[model samples]
Target chain A: MEYPSRLIENAVGEISKLPGIGKKTALRLVLHLLKEPEGTTAELTEALTELRTKIKYCKDCHNISDDEVCNICASHRRDRSIICVVEDTRDVLAIENTAQYTGLYHILGGVISPIEGIGPSELNIDQLLQRIENNKNEVKEVIFALSPTMEGDTTAFYLTKKLRQFGVKISTIARGIPIGGELEYTDEITLGRSILSRTAYQQD
Target chain B: MEYPSRLIENAVGEISKLPGIGKKTALRLVLHLLKEPEGTTAELTEALTELRTKIKYCKDCHNISDDEVCNICASHRRDRSIICVVEDTRDVLAIENTAQYTGLYHILGGVISPIEGIGPSELNIDQLLQRIENNKNEVKEVIFALSPTMEGDTTAFYLTKKLRQFGVKISTIARGIPIGGELEYTDEITLGRSILSRTAYQQD
Candidate 1:
């Protein structure tokens, strides 16, 4: 549908480009922004602009960072020798929110998904390998803390085989159906638990 | 818990201010933005910044416009004598999308809500009366195309009482429960229809 004004249309277009925001929701958001003082809208715009300009991939862990190294990688108190491998930054944040882990992290940037044309070459796996090679003697464990998706499993297995030569300990999160989750909506947790609880991976 | 980086935190904080966007969704959106090239991010930032610099309210109708007067108000094809009152620019866009109305619009900026501390003084209602008085007999019907809510009703009633002194025709949109709506979620649309269809309000 045609917009009454160019400004409204432009605002909605920009908002709709955000993840999970459709045109209707974009329109609603733009209208809401219109009501607030001009400075508020300016502040949001300025922040987004600055976000891109100031942020970069941390050289040490590949997680988002304002400095050369991310906070997790730079912290002296964390277990530097034990790195938790995650598929993305959100997983890092999720684990951090629990305050249960105090280890360094290695962001894979993404998992191996052949369907999406993302293969081993596209990932920073070589950098990870180099890191492992350099720290082989000092490092104790390398936790495969990626999600329990098929791609996640594939990447984990691939890493385990590749790193077996380096003689580092590897582990994954214990899986089971989540509390308060329905059987149908039970994700990798339930599926992985069912598989693990079996004698071994066998024919259906 | 502390964020992996300050950049992620800043982006999430700004995005969370948007309507219906929580910190989680803001993170998702920020991640999406990160995947894009610098040009795309810059374009959106520039557009948002310029929106505030460019847009202004039309002096005659109070609708948002890039110029001294809005397109709808300035256009010769539109019926200048008829004015449609709406809550905001979004309503104007919705009605314009229908392509049914060819009249000018008066944006009240917002409706009357005592709890929100908004009243007639906060709105452009005085400018509306001034518009009618300035034009006198040239103005014909004033359509109240506001939302069918308690605040909307209060604003309409208040306007009707005030406009009665000016001897101008006033009308409201026909009401019924919306099409494709479940009965359980239906509000007082049926009640509104009964009241609107009442014969006493009719001039004939």
Candidate 2:
């Protein structure tokens, strides 16, 4: 589509570069920004600039942070002996929201996907190994909380092989039907796995 | 959701302030930006800043433009005797893309909507009237190309009442079933309108 102004075209071009956002949505957003007060655009640009330029990652877990280490890594109440390995910061947030896991996190940044040209070396695998090696006695368990995709499985397999030599207990999060999911609608693989991994019923 | 960094939180907060964007989507965009090279984020912010700061409106039609007068208004090829009144720049672009209309445009910026607290005074209706008054002899027609909604009808009605003394012909774009629209799935109102405004059958 032809834009009336060069500035608008440029703004739309830049915004549409983002994932899931198309040229139409970008134009709508740019037009919305034009309609809002000048301060609104200023604040948005300032915030994005600060985020891109000054944002830091936790030295230990590779999760997003403002300081040398993330809060989860620094907290004394967290179980430092167990590290929950995940793909990215979003996964960390999702697991944290559950409030069931008190262990520190090890953000691998991404999984080992050959199709995407992301290998084990491209991720935080070395940092994770170093973390486990530095406190071998203190770190007892390493839980793989990555997705159920093939890439996640490959990464977990790779990490398991590395951790076996260190004599650390390695586990992966369970794969099964979601809590509220109906058995009939559940995928065959998930239903089959759920049945195979079934536990004894307990009275509440 | 808990954000690991203050900068991430701030960026998400600002981005979520935009229309249609939520906290989750904002975080996803922010995280994507973080993963990309810093230069990408810088370019996006720079473009938006320049757009918000340097954008101009057409002096004659109120459409977005790089200069005081829009290209449409300055074009000698356009029909000066006819003016197509529209809601905003998007409408102008849509009409232009059709390549059917050769007349210049006067962007109302918005329609008359009492529920949204938008009155005639809030739009560029006065400028449109002034344009017609200044070029009374040259201008022969004023076409209303607003959406087929209550606000649009109200705005058109108000303008028609104002322009009654000018002796200029007033018209509106046809409202009916769109081309390529299936009759079975078309809304009753639109189908009824199509039947009511049926034109003479002409062989191609």
Candidate 3:
């Protein structure tokens, strides 16, 4: 669309380059920023630029960090022996929010997607292996917390093969009917898995 | 959710302030930016900041502009006698995309929303009146191209009252069933209005 101002068009065009944002959405967002106090946009700009430029990846898990090692990896209270391997920092945050796990994370950065030219080598696979090798005795179980996609499965299989030699127990997060899900609405594959993976129920 | 880094957290917080973006979406967007080349984030930040800080409003129409007068208002070919009044620059772009209009435009900046405490004083109402008074002989018609909302109708009613003494022709865009709208699916009020405003069909 022909914009009245080139600055607005440029701003919208640049913002629309982000994932899930379209031209119209970009315009709306830009207009919102324009209407807001000057400090708001300036703060947003500074924070984003600082995030991209000065941000560092955790040495152990490859998650975002202000320093060389992330807080989770450095914390003595966290169970570093049990590393939860996942695709990215978002997964790390998701699992952290659950409050079910108190372990360190290994961000794979990406899945083993050949179509996207991303393989095991493209991610932090080598760093993960080195981390395991250096702390072999301390590291006990490694959970495959990646999404239940084909690529996630392939990556898990590859990691399982590599981790077995280290004598570490490897497990995957369960995928089945959710806690509040109805049986009639559950998908066939999930329902089948739920039945197959059923454990002896213990009365609490 | 707890972020691994303060920078990432700050960026996500700022981004989540935008319309339609939540914490999860903001984190996803922030991670995507982190994965991309540094130049991409830098450019987006620069463009948005520049747009917010340097962009000027057109003196004549009060629309976004890089100069004192916007392109449409300053252009020699555009019909100076006719002016299309809209709420903001987005409407200007929408009408321009139609490729039907050749007239100038007046941006009201906002509508009269009593609940939001916005009235005629909040918009560019006085500037529009002055423009009409200064160019009384040259300006012939003023088109009310505002959206069809309660606030839009209220603004139109107010403008009509103010413009009656100017002796200039004033009209609103047609309101009825849309061009390709299905009759069965059309709303009651729109359908009723379409039937009431139906013109005599003449064989071409």
Best by DockQ: 2
Q: List per-prediction Cα lDDT, in the order shown.
A: 0.84, 0.93, 0.92
lDDT of 3 by residue, B33-145 (tens): 98899999989999988998899999999999999988888899999999899999899999999999999999999999999999999999999999999999999999999
Docking quality (DockQ) of candidate 1: 0.64
Question: Higher-DockQ candidate among 1 and 2?
Answer: 2
TM-score of each: 0.90, 0.97, 0.96
User: Model 1, A102: alpha-carbon shift in Å?
Assistant: 2.4
DockQ of each: 0.64, 0.93, 0.88
Docking class of 3: high
Native interface contact recovery, model 2: 0.98
Ranking by lDDT: 2, 3, 1
**Candidate 1: where are CA atoms >4 Å away?**
A179-192, A198-204, B179-192, B195-204
Error of 2 at A143 (Å): 0.5
lDDT of 1 by residue, A54-93 (tens): 7888887888887888777788899878889888889898
Candidate 3, residues A1-204, lDDT tens digits: the string is: 788888988998999999999999999999999888999999999999889999998888888899999899889899878999999887888888899999889999999999999988998888989999999889999999998889999999999988878999899999889999999999998999989998788999
The per-residue C-alpha lDDT of model 1 at residue A20 equals 79
